[model samples]
Target chain A: MIGEFSPGLILILGALLVPLLRGRLRAIYMLALPVAAFAHLTTLPHGDLGIIELSGVSLTTLRVDKLSLLFSYVFLVAALICVIYSLHLRDTVQHVAALIYAGSAMGAIFAGDLVTLFIYWEAIAIASVFLIWASRTEDSYRSGMRYLIIQVGSGVLLLAGVLIHYRQTGSLAFGALGLDTPGGLLIFLAFGIKSAFPVLHAWLPDAYPRGTPTGTVFLSAFTTKVAIYALARSFAGTDILIPIGTVMAAFPIFYAVIENDLRRVLAYSLNNQLGFMVVGIGLGTDLALNGAVAHAFADILFKGLLFMSMGAVLFRVGTIKGSELGGLYKSMPWTTGFCIVGAASISAFPLFSGFVTKSMIMTAAMEEGYFWIWIVLLFASAGVFHHAGIKIPYFAFFAHDSGKRCQEAPLNMLVAMAVAAALCIGIGSFPDFFYTLLPFETGYRPYTLDHVVAQVQLLFLSALAFTLLMRTGIYPPELRSVNIDAEWFYRRAGRSLADGARMAAENGWKSVTHGIGRTISVVIAYVQRHHGPEGLLARPWPAGTMALWTTLMLGACLILFYL
Target chain B: MSAHRDPKEKRYWLDDPANVTRLVRVFYVVCAALIAIDVFVPKHGPFAIEHWFGFYGFFGFLACVALVLIAKQLRKVLMRPEDYYDR
Candidate 1:
């Protein structure tokens, strides 16, 4: 029997048995994997449990701490919810992929050394791509390939950083790695890429919407949150991250405002939410860090809820494009209601999950004297509510009637969504219980009258602005269009650059080959001109002429030798 | 409630344009009332900016309007036909 193992190993190894079962048995088994892991995680003491020396270097496979434990619990919760959402899927590949993906994310969070984190990091990237490929569309295939390359590239950066850092520091410990050296900077970049740091963020919006509906819900939860956990562990209080987080918070809302794919809109919203957490980490106070981790927990559930609701709509209506979808509330009332809850939560309405967690970050920033940063964050908060909070449900479910009719989302889908929605409310209403799970101790209260009144005023007025903009026709309509983002550098400009390079190589080779052929032909012609039958050497000369020529050549040779 | 609607009435409550107008009117009152609470309720924050009456409300309103308007103009440069990547 096993004494102890990383809880993540359960899901990773259990995925192998998923194919052997069918239907309800498979669902039950899949659900049980996380449930068992969560129970095991709760029982495990906070210490390094699996340490073995490999080549004189001790590799730690399991390191349980408050931070890792918090992240692991959320990962398991997400895995269960996502599995429930996908219960109707007959596709075995998605089930296995999602299980392994979630497991790898959990593994990354608990890793005590860079090597362990790197292995699970790569595994997470490779396993999650199957979710995108499970869509089985040409677009999904190509998108998955790109996503795989960039994600694996991030792993490569992490591995390189780990090697360099080990050579310099003589250890592979995953601890506070400030950016004072090349290795540390490389590791930070790896985390930045995963966290969707501005320019590095293109892959997320590109690939996430391409995943199968249930697959996207799984996609939304794990990968980025792991990056946040890593960053919080290693790079907390780094000054550059504040600016980086600012841009990440600011720019995405603009893009989300015009993005047509509703799921893609959420992807942008996810980036904006990550920015909030990153800033919290940057502040690095107890309240800030606690706020960051807590906000991540809230984001996972509410963001998952939002994604699940849209997935339900996509499952029934067969379209998630905002241009083609509207007025779906009549046909799918429960989904619409759940979606509103998610919207309200994301908007940080009073007595919601977002309000409790986000307030900590904002308050922490102010306490830390990030005056301008706090101001910008306030603006970002309003913008987040405007785009994600208002635009998503407003455009998809209630803007105008696309006149599309369908059944409500399947029972399993509704159950999954309802569970997620309930959790969003539960965490919002009773955050005291949730606060116990935070890595840091705090006596912060979220229900202050001033804070509540301020938040409510901000949200309500944002809604009013939306209403006024719609009434005056200043608001852009949902349309069948695309917006160029940082991804434009790769998707269009990068493609053309590759094409141009190929064309240049082709022309260069053709010219070189043409010159070589021309020279060869010239040599051949010159040879034929003298040696062919019609040439002087080939002409039938008399024997006397040959003899005379030979005599002349002999005399010249004799003269030259004498000289 | 929707299931028990009259057969003669084809439109739901949300479908009526008048209800939406009244809702907007009520929304306006709600916004006004929310700001009015600032007078009676004590305000506290790290900075003096938080003490300004209806600061968040106005900031939220202006910020959202600016985002929309700026984003609308952004479309001029960033917007492409639906199949921009495919082509």
Candidate 2:
């Protein structure tokens, strides 16, 4: 029975107990829940578990396959890391929300049927918004509301698609439903919104930086990766994703470069990295699929590590703005070291985790004859190194000293970063460990002579360019400003439209009232003249007037008859 | 006066002007060394363009330059005060 139990439920139930526990016990309990789930995940065989029939439709709540198992492992690991990072906080609400968020993501991964998947999908959306709300700022509250609306909107689309899909085919099984059907396209767009596909991407950059420090670490790990998993599960090899993914990869780099909030820039970089995985899913070859999955795995660790380091900085310094931070390496050397590891991993430096995983996607692109996409990917790669690798560290730790000093990151935060950092290096050095966990087997090697040389050249030259630009003062300086993004159309134009509608309604109401007043006045004057004690009918000779009126009416009737 | 300076100020190595100069020089030297490696190794590229000396180097450098320039121009159109949304 324990073996058949859904690992996700274990964490979800554990979330309820968070309020009952005390300080050290609470930390231990939180950490132990993910470990238990991961252990349960490893013991299960590759078959459907937790089957229940609802209204004659079979709902499989747990599906133990390689893909599901791999994602669950990483999800649990990220949860553990986040729990450790947030151990200093006394906020029970955030702790509970983080657990539910991670658990629901894991549930969605193991969901064997569409209905079960939809349930978990909505759960993830609802649970994760609290992370944004935990910041307790008006901005965070507003952004969290926006995040909730968009996420729930995706869920509604998914529900509609599921209903339509079930009608088209009498099965609620979740599998590869291509874009040929209307339902399938709807499902694809739903996943696209969650995956941060270009126009649907604004929520990520908008809301991610608004989360509390520890909340962001959890936020960065789950939502988009779940979408990537869903896309890999359903829409693999869709040619449209190729171009869509290429734009996703390429456009974010420009925004990342100019973004002043260090965490927001990482969020943009996260979008860029997700692009590579999306492209791989489009390729849909064994190598490409493996690349996408492998990159997803690597991304969670590195991106989580990056977000953790920045979170620690935010916790200590009270701000993550690039313009407001510099020379923090003086006060926070361990964080600096870990941040560099994360930056290098994200930038795909050779002997780092990104190099081993990201190369698979590039190799997949070249092999599939997507030469132009490959070139754009290459440009994105270089651009990522410029902004994320060089700029995050350069501005935060090494640039002109902002003359602000703070205490080093707390011990719990340091321990979390160290663990994630070790994993990044471990996976990079031993790619075989991660490759074995991938859903597909591949003979691809990441450390081939040409691959290593090419990657090194690209990264080093990008670094060279950063150096030159900084010296020449050609690079844009970080300022205390916000860059308008796709969200602008809604935040600005949408408000204006609403305002215009409100003004029109007010004017229309005013005009209607004025017209009614004039009509009432005219009617009252006519009444006063005809029936009130004013004119004609109210005169003393009413009887004579009535007789004359009757005679005139009779004469007019006779005239009409004659005519 | 020196004693009145923040204790953390003395711990930062880059606070010294000499150390800053040395770090800059080291960065330039490393760049030069990386570029020099192009002369020694033969590139096994799939395209003819890759056969050009320092192709990746030039591309990386130019890409960064272009990204910054384009982003600078984009900022002219897109940048707003930090409280743009608040207002």
**Using Cα atoms with residue i matched to residue i, what is each candidate's TM-score against the true structure?**
0.92, 0.91
- Candidate 2 DockQ score? 0.54
- Residue B76 lDDT in model 1? 94
- Candidate 2: regions farther than 4 A off: A1-3, A510-563, B1-11, B39-45
State the fnat of model 1.
0.87
Can you tell me the CAPRI class of model 2?
Answer: medium
**Candidate 1 docking classification:** medium
Give chain A TM for each model in order: 0.92, 0.92
Distance from true location, Cα of A85 in model 2, Å: 0.5
Could you give candidate 1's per-residue lDDT for residues A1-563 as a string of tens digits? 15567889999999989999997788889989999999888788878878867989998888998899888888899999999999999999999999999999999998999999999999999999999999999999999999999999999999999999999999899999979988999999999999999999999999999999999999999999999999999999998888888888888999999989999999999999999999999888999999999999999999999999999999998999999998788889999999999999998997789999999999999988888999889989999999989999988888777767789999999998899889989989988999999998989999988888899999999999999999889899887898988889989999999889999999999999999999999998888888787776678889998899999999999999999
